[model samples]
Target: MIYDFILVGHGLAGGILARTLSEQGYKLAVFDTFKANSASRVAAGLINPLAGKRFAKSWLAEKLVPFAIAFYQQIEKEFNVKIWQPLPIFKFFSSVEEQNTWMGKSSNPAIQEFIKQVHLRLPFSESINQDFGAIEIAQSGYVDVNKFLDCLLVALAQSHLLIQEFFEFSRLNLNADFITYKQDNNTITARKIVFCEGFQAINNPYFSWLPFSLNKGEVLDIKVDNLPAECIYNKAVYVLPFGTDGFKVGATYNWREINEQPSAEALTELTERAGQILKKRFVVTKQAAGIRPAVKDRRPLMGWHPVHHQIGIFNGMGSKGVMMAPYLAHNFVANLQGAKLEPEADISRFLKYFTGI
Candidate 1:
């Protein structure tokens, strides 16, 4: 039987895309080995609209945030599993200048949509150090990425839609209308193959030409006392509230050493930064590292292979996969059905690099 789509890599992107296509009445098979230290497994699952030191709104945040929230909530209702948790982000102001800048930008209608409140005097002064005060960002939260992926994989496995193995490029045979691959004693066929292999895409012969700027990031989970559990606290480093008395601190970016091993330098950096923010005693509980599948221009990669029309990619989500995957997955499916992809994300932008074209 020829499946409508065969997805490679069941990480965040592939999982969401598989669900999107399946709900649209497409038969699909997912290929994955569930590798450890994958970006999806190590992601903090933040959904912040405002990003960077300047606090500019994320690309397409107005549309992506609402759509993502609805999509995750719908999945929860259908599966009866808890994954999406909405929480506010308290962005601490580093200096009076930063506070003034925010004060000025808060009046804009676009920025106002995400601003819950702006404080001149530090809020939660007893526990946090925000001398210049902070701004509470609305419509912010995190997804329990591990739980979501695990639940989805289980359902897929039960339905015989998941193939727990790596996809070997040499075994794939592409025809004019469909593609076939040899797996053990069986031959699996699919009309189209979409690769969502994350940073590992760099090794894929077809899609490797796409400019990938991968980065390794490390996050630490800690148990702390007296820090507020109501919201995520952020300054230089983010202290995300987890279970009772626990917080996930992290994310040191290291582009030089792009591997999945946690480093002592990153651990020290995270703990020290977290210490400056949370004045209470804390104990490190866990440390994780993963490589983000970032692009040079910092946008998702989507679209068909320039020469191989049957091949496609839906990857390079970087740190925003939790928020971007759902909406982007829907959009990608729409593109497959004759709609246009968002130009910035379309791999067509790099068509010149594809020698096959």
Candidate 2:
């Protein structure tokens, strides 16, 4: 029996796509191996409207953040699970000049709604070094990715829509109408097979040529006493409140070290950075590393293969997956149903790469 779609990789992209398609009344199957080092597994799942050192609003943040909140809230109500933590993000200024820069940008119409408060003196004064103060951003929060994924997996399993296995590209056969995959003795056919593999896509023969700027990130879980638990703190690295008195400190970016193993050098670097910014004492509990599926142009990649019309790709979300996935997934499925997609996200933007310009 042929299905509407066969989704590969059950990370954020795959999960969202699967759910979006299923909700649209399409018969679909999802393939996932549940790798430990996948970006979604290690990501803090931050949804920040205003981000980065420049304190500029994220691309399409106004639309994406609200869509994500509504989407996750709907998921929570349907699944009876707790995963999203809606809270403000406290971005600290490195110097008075940086504070002035923030104040200048705060008046911009695009950024006004997300600015909850500007503090000359931070709320948490004792446990943090805030010489230049911090700004509390509204409509910012984090999604516990592990919990969210677990909830999705359980829902998919109950319906027998999830396949727990690795996808081998060698056994794939692409046809004009459908794509067939030979798994052991059984065969499965689908109208379209979408690859949602994260950084692993770097090795996918079908998508390997799509310029991917894979970056490795290291994060730490720590227990900090006397640290404020009300909001996410961003200085050198982000300090997110986790369990009781627990915080997640991260992350160090390394374009060279894309391996899964946590590096000692990264740990030291994070420790020093956290120490310089955090006045509270903390103990490291865990360390993790994951490779980000970033693109050279910093936009998501979505569209069919130039030659294989039956095969498609939806990836390259980078760090903004938490905020962008819901809206993008909705729009992606819309594109499949005859609506045009934004050119920035459409792989057609890079057709020159495949068409031999």
Candidate 3:
């Protein structure tokens, strides 16, 4: 085979998989059709140890967090670029009722080590609506996703390992030894073809029955010249800085699954939420909507196709792609190398009845 693996998409999942395999000395090629509103592209790339208004500990944070930090660091060293920045998330408190609830749950031990209650002013207090001050989430930050991908893309191009095209299903041909694709008017062979098509994979004929519900997400890119330059601001709506004089403010979820364009209503709603969080209004520079590849059970989809020996999938990280990709990719690669399945994220759990295991 000319390549040991052919990876589709350069989103979090595909990037993680390709990099991991390449580190193990596997020959690889990545094909990606750039879309403006792709989830990872629009994402604030926020990672928090605890989640929700009630502040519950994130699922598998102890394991996932360390793995993510180390993995991104390794990639950064290789590319000679800095992408992951660990900034505190200042979660401001609103109503008195909400403050009471938070105070009561502060000692739950679920988030004890990660949460720090604060009455002092954070840097955002100067430009934010920090009514009752806030608790700083020590283990929260945002990833510079676009920049990370940019560095990776350049590196891949230099290595002659990337392609940019909408991978067509019609070109996929499976044989005993390799999976081949008629790409860029040339025939290419790979030991295995892994699909990271994101939300579009719901329509893939082979794996359509996996039960995925796509959610359209709308996010805003607003320029705020007077805001704090350090740490992400997470109140009702998260405000993440994306370098330069801009901040990425998002996001409203519309579970209806229409992803044609950014809805005016959604844009208005996002702006309204931002106004509530920020002390002053900012310019809405850009608005976009992308359908998240959300799965029914809300876990990532990884591992081999049920019947196709050389075909596979690595997707469904959903809104948590930035936080989940490295950990899940490690598991998937281990499984592909004939190691035992890790208990949590194996795709076989979902296909148990279908596979009769």
Candidate 4:
């Protein structure tokens, strides 16, 4: 069957692109294996305006956060599911100096909206050891990514738009304007093909040459009584409440030995770190690992293939996929329709590598 687009991978990137394309009345099909450790499936889906050790505003935070909130809220309404949780992220300061730095940052008009207040001490929980107090961020929350993706998957299947199979690069045939995929007993042709394969793109013959410094991250699902369920608690790691009693504590970023397998060393590290902050006892119930599709410059990769104009990619969102995907996906859709995306995100920045110059 002829289609407008064929998307490879059904992670956050693929899912967002699919939603955008389908909303625009484009006939698109998705091919995915739904790997357990796929980046999107394993993400805690935190959408924070201020990030990193310095607690500076995230790149394009002003644009990405609002779009993400609206996008996820829209999806929630369409799917009739509770996915977007507009909660706050309470970042604990390790020292007085850091707390003072946050106080100064909160005064900036550009960042004031996101900073609810810088706390001198966490009033609710003595279990958390924030000597220098914490800063409660406004308009920050975690997305129920798994639930969101599951609902989308079902909806796509109901509409015959999802194919639960691994994409084979060898079976893909690209032309000047269209591409064809030869599967087991059927062939699907599309005007354009976009790869949103996450870290697996490193193995994709088409995009493998792109600079990808993938990192392995591990998280543990634990039940901690003292931690409040209302807001995300962040220190060395984040304690994101999943339900009334369960919290997701993560994550260890390992540059080497990157894989989906959860490691014992990481488990030990997390438990120890969590212990330092929590005065209450917690039990590790489950562990998960996934490779983040990060890049050297920490910007997303989007745009059509330099040589194969009909081929494109929407990936390299890294840990911020929860916030970045929706907005970037919208921009990507616009670019596909003859508009231009942000210069930094456009894959054309690396066109020199593709051109052998």
Local distance difference test scores for all models: 0.90, 0.86, 0.79, 0.87
Instruction: Please estimate how well model 4 matches the true structure, expressed as its whole-model Cα lDDT.
Output: 0.87
Colliding pairs, model 3: none
Order of candidate numbers by TM-score, starting with the best: 1, 2, 4, 3
Best by TM-score: 1
Instruction: Report the C-alpha lDDT of model 3 over 67-117, residue by residue, as the tens digit.
Output: 898887887887788888888887877866667777777777767777766
- Candidate closer to the true structure by TM-score (higher is better), 1 or 2: 1
Q: What local lDDT score does residue 16 receive in model 1, on the 0 to 100 scale?
A: 92
Pairs in steric clash, model 4: none
**Ten-residue segment with the worst summed lDDT in candidate 3?**
117-126
Query: Candidate 4, which segments miss by more than 4 Å at Cα?
Result: 355-357
Task: List per-candidate RMSD values in Å.
Answer: 1.2, 1.6, 2.6, 1.6
Q: Point to the candidate with the largest lDDT.
A: 1
Question: Could you tell which candidate, 3 or 4, scores higher by lDDT?
Answer: 4
Error of 4 at 90 (Å): 1.2
Query: How well is each residue in 220-336 modelled by candidate 1, as lDDT tens digits?
Result: 999987777888999878899875568899788889999888999999999999988887889999999999999999999999998789999999989899889888999999998
TM-score of each model, paired residue for residue: 0.97, 0.96, 0.91, 0.96
- Cα lDDT of model 3 overall? 0.79
